[model samples]
Target chain A: MHLYDSTIPSGNAYKVQLLLSHLHIPYAITSLNILATPPETRSSDFLAINPNGRIPVFILDDGTPLIESNAIMFYLAEGTPYLPDDKLAKAQVLQWLFFEQYSHEPYVAVWKFRTYWALNGFEDLSGREIQKLKERGQAAIDVMERHLEGREWFVGTNYSIADIALFAYTSAAEQIGFSVGPNVKAWLSRVEGTKGWVKIKKDETGKCPL
Target chain B: MHLYDSTIPSGNAYKVQLLLSHLHIPYAITSLNILATPPETRSSDFLAINPNGRIPVFILDDGTPLIESNAIMFYLAEGTPYLPDDKLAKAQVLQWLFFEQYSHEPYVAVWKFRTYWALNGFEDLSGREIQKLKERGQAAIDVMERHLEGREWFVGTNYSIADIALFAYTSAAEQIGFSVGPNVKAWLSRVEGTKGWVKIKKDETGKCPL
Candidate 1:
């Protein structure tokens, strides 16, 4: 299998990398600077691979294209310890994954990316926009914190892709000046201790290694 | 099984309803007005069932709550015809569901909801916000159009949950003055023809009926 990687930091893409490393899947990476203006993701070539024009597009062993970071990771971790075999437990894992994409990433991840690339720094952001991002992003983080209050992992009892999915961005919360609750912070650390865990690398631009 | 249905129009909730009716799974709905300001979803009682406080929270026969609309549908559709057994095809269904949540619903569904619920009118929206919504929402619709080209369903050869996920909102595009490509319109027509398909009903609030 081959994964089209992004040269810039991407939590969505990172989710795939973490799972691949955990599964001991030795695959190839073709890094593209998707962050560049008119992102390479928009090119016809990338578009042909993923009409959505996004990164973390995985090419299966059969050479078929699979997009969506969570979907790709779920495929890879299906039989691994990262994905539960129990049906309802499996669905709960999915619930968090969807929450990560819809509630968490949209606010937290976008804020991290835009603020990292912001030419004029956080002060340049409109007060209202900044406040909204802070409030909403914090709300998402709060949800995770509350969920982790009496639990160690997002799912039943083990670490799953649900952890990797949210860990990608939630781990970066403090770096972006977004305050994370204590429970989330502690859970983030627990994720780091998981077997086969790999760190997300980035350069001075606060982005993925090129 | 019981589903905590929402009284107001929710494309997410509608996806579950359409599927249950199609699957002929006899279940009960406890409608709550989640669209109310400080949404009823935020109430302590609703939060007990779903920490996310969203509707379409499905309770299994054992009384376990499954949140996330797509997750609930996926759970219910398991071992059924609506969800494929093939590995890769299942991922494809999930990819589109994520696409619907991340790309499509954020813009298309939100636009339809805000515009429909806007006390004044869509005209009351800020010019820049409106423009952004139109462009992003249309881009999502365009992706679906391209995918539907020469295809009858969103995934493989069958009408899976992917079709229901996108159909809940894509079908409402025209009602909001959004233009959909011919192929997308044709596919929408095809979805309606699926066996046991049920229409999403609504009351005067542009939402599901009582």
Candidate 2:
């Protein structure tokens, strides 16, 4: 497999990298400079590979390119313990994945991106916009905290891709100024303790490619 | 099956209604008054059904509540033609489903909601915000047009749930001031022509519940 990813930290891209590590799948990467003026993702060449012009486009050995990070994780985790066999359990996994993309990522990931950019000397969002982002991001975190009250993982008893999907962004919450509840804080530690787990900054083999 | 839906038009809930119509499944609905101040979805009773406070919560015969519109469609379409059997094709279907939620629905559906509210004497968004929504919504439509250049459906040769997911909001593009390209326009007609297809405001068996 070949992955068109970003040099910057993107939780969407990292979800795929984390799952690949769990499965021990080795693949080549082409890291695009997303922070570059005009961003490499919007270039005509990159857009040809993905019309939406987003990174983490995973190319199968057969040359078919797949976009969307959660979908890619779903594709990679098939037949593995990371994706359950029970129909309802699988659907529950997907429900969390969708929730991560629609509810969690938009606020948490965007706030983290803005904070990263601001720390690096670029501030685009106003105080009000940032405040809204923080509040909404906190709401998503609270949902996770409530869901994790008695559960170890997001879905069934086992740690599944649903956990990985939410963990990719939630792991960075505190750094972006959102308080992590005790349940979520402990769950983050549990995710890190999972066998063969890799940090967002590293590749599948525990190597920091950048 | 029992569905907790909205009294108003919701593309998210309509995806389930359309799929159930195609599958000839009989289900009961508890339509919440979402347009009411404070919205019934946020009420304690409805929140008990779905912590997310969102509609289109489908409950199975054994009483397992399913959230997320696309996830519900995936569970319902498991053995049907609406979801395919091939692994790669299935992944592609999911890719579009995620894209619809993340990229398409936010802009297009929000624009529609704002327009509906403004026409009904409640103006929440400024003109500038509305313009931004229109531009972003058009960008999503443009991506769909490029993908549908020669294809009859969003994924594979059949009319899978990928088409259904995208079609839910894209069908309303022109009504909300976004232009529909030729390819997407034709594809909408094709989706409407599918067997067991129902309008967004109608339930299964082709009755307008509202």
Candidate 3:
């Protein structure tokens, strides 16, 4: 299988890469430069693979182009030890995945884009825009900190997709100009201690080094 | 199982409510007023039920509080007609759900918050901030329009969770200050015409009349 990702370490992309590493799935990675004007993702070749033109698109061994990152994670980890067998537990995992995208990622991601991608005079950044991003981002962080109190992971008594989804951007909260807080900071360490864990940009050739 | 949902027509909350309606499951709807400063969701009583302090939290018949809207939807629909039986097909559904969160909902929901909650006056909405929001919101709408071309719903054949998730907001796009293009506007009609479909708001009790 081949995974097409981008330079920015998106939580959504990291979800796919994390699952593939944990499951020890053999896959090759291709990096696209999204920062480039008319992003490489808009190229005809990439669009043929994913009409939506987003990253963490998985090209299956049979050449099926699977676009959403969580879906790629689900496809690779289905029936594996990482996925919960209990019906309700699995739904809980999906719940956090949704939360990561809805409540969590929006705030954190826009912060990162404003600070990193949208910086450097590429386009003018207004003071009001930055203020809103910071306010929204902080609100999201507060929610995560409160929820992590006394909890090992997002789900019940185990490290599941919930951990993978949230951990992707969360570990790099500071880079986005936000803090993960004490409880969530502690939870990050616990997630890192998990066996077969991998960082977002650790590979030389973008392949699973493990 | 009983479902505790707010009176507010939240897209995320409606996901769970819609599924239960489709299944004809006996459930209770608890109206929560989020506009109440120190909202009911933030109170200690609700916190004991869900530490996350968010609405659309689902409590099972046994009093297990399931937070996150999509999580509750999947939990209710698992092994039922809502979730696709085929593996890849189901993964496709999950992909759209993730897309709804990461790409679709952020811009749509924020635009809604600004318009409905009137964040413009609550905070200073400068010309620059307004322009940026419009740009971002239109980008999101364009993406949805491109994806919806020649399709009745988000996925190819069935009206799965993807439709449910996206329908929650896209249906209300205009009210939230988003312009639904010709394609998306047509698709909205098709979605509402589905057999088990329900609208976001209720007449008096703010309960889904299904």
Candidate 4:
């Protein structure tokens, strides 16, 4: 299997990488320069791999390419300890996964992107837009804090992909200026202590093989 | 199962309703006044059911309330024709589901909401914001158009939840001033022709059971 990813840190791509690490699956990575003038993700070659023109496209051993990070995680975690067998449990995991993509990442990840890129002299959002991102991103964090009040994991008693999905972005909240409540902070600590955990690597040099 | 939904024509909520109608599952709906001042979805009572305070919450026979429309659809579509049994096909369905929520609905549904509410003297987005919504929304539609070039459905050989999820918003694109390409239009007609299909009923009278 191979993962078409980016050099810049992406929580969405990292979700797959984290899960693959936990599962001890060996795969090759093809990093793309998404911050380039014409982002490599939008290039014809990459678009051929994923029409959506996004990274973290996982190719199966049979050469079938799958896009969407959460979906790829779902595919990878199937029949493993990371994914529960009970019907309701699987659905709950999916609920959090969708919530992460729709509510959490749009704000938290976008804020991180804008903030990080602005430091490099690329400003994408206006002042007002940044304020909205902060408010919305904090709201998403608050939701996670409340959900973690009496629970260790997002779905059930055991650690599941739901934790992996939310952990990717929520862990970076404090670094990105969003306040993390005690519950979420504790939960992040628990996620970090999980076996076979790997840190997201930063690739400062923007270079990729064609 | 009972569905906690809103009277307003919500593409997210409609995705669940359309699936239930297809499966011939009888479920009661508790419509909330989502357009009201302070929106009943954010009320303490509803919040207790779903902390996220979003509508289309599907309660199981065991009284477990499930949030997220796609998750509810996944739970209901299991062991049914709407959800495939093949692993890769299932992942493909989810890929489109995530794409719909992340890439498609935010723009198309938000554009539709702003345009519809503007007619009733409720303006939420500024002129510039509306333009951005238009461009983004049309870009989403163009992606769908390209995907539907020679395909009848979003995933696999038959109509799955992917089609249902995308159809909820894409069907209304023309009414909101977004042009639908020929391929997407034909695919929309195919979706409309599916068995057990139901139209999204618009409740203009803003009343709901407390």
Scoring only the A-chain of each prediction against the true A-chain gives TM-scores of 0.93, 0.92, 0.88, 0.93
Q: With candidate 3 superimposed using the best TM-score fit, by how many Å does residue B74's alpha carbon deviate from the native?
A: 1.4
DockQ of 1: 0.84
- Report the error of model 2 at residue B101, Å: 0.3
Candidate 4's residue-wise lDDT over B91-116, tens digit each? Answer: 99999999999988988888777666
> Against the true two-chain complex, what DockQ does each candidate achieve?
0.84, 0.84, 0.61, 0.87
lDDT of 4 by residue, A100-168 (tens): 998899898887776575344225445676778889889889989998989999988999999999999
Model 3, A1-210: lDDT tens digits are: 898988765667778888888888888989897767889998989987776678989988888788787777777777886778888788777877776777767767766655555536325656766666677777777877887888888778888877888888777787656866899888889888888898777533332222
lDDT of 2: 0.87
lDDT of every predicted structure (CA atoms): 0.85, 0.87, 0.74, 0.87
Better of 2 and 4 by DockQ: 4
Model 2, residue B17: distance off in Å is: 0.1
Distance from true location, Cα of A106 in model 4, Å: 0.4
- For model 2, give the TM-score of chain B: 0.92
Rank the candidate models, highest DockQ first: 4, 1, 2, 3
User: Per lDDT, what order, best first?
Assistant: 2, 4, 1, 3
Better of 1 and 4 by DockQ: 4
Local error of candidate 2 at B67, Å? 0.2
Question: Largest DockQ belongs to which candidate?
Answer: 4
List model 1 lDDT by residue over A138-197, tens digit each: 888988888899899999889999999999999889877777888998899998998889
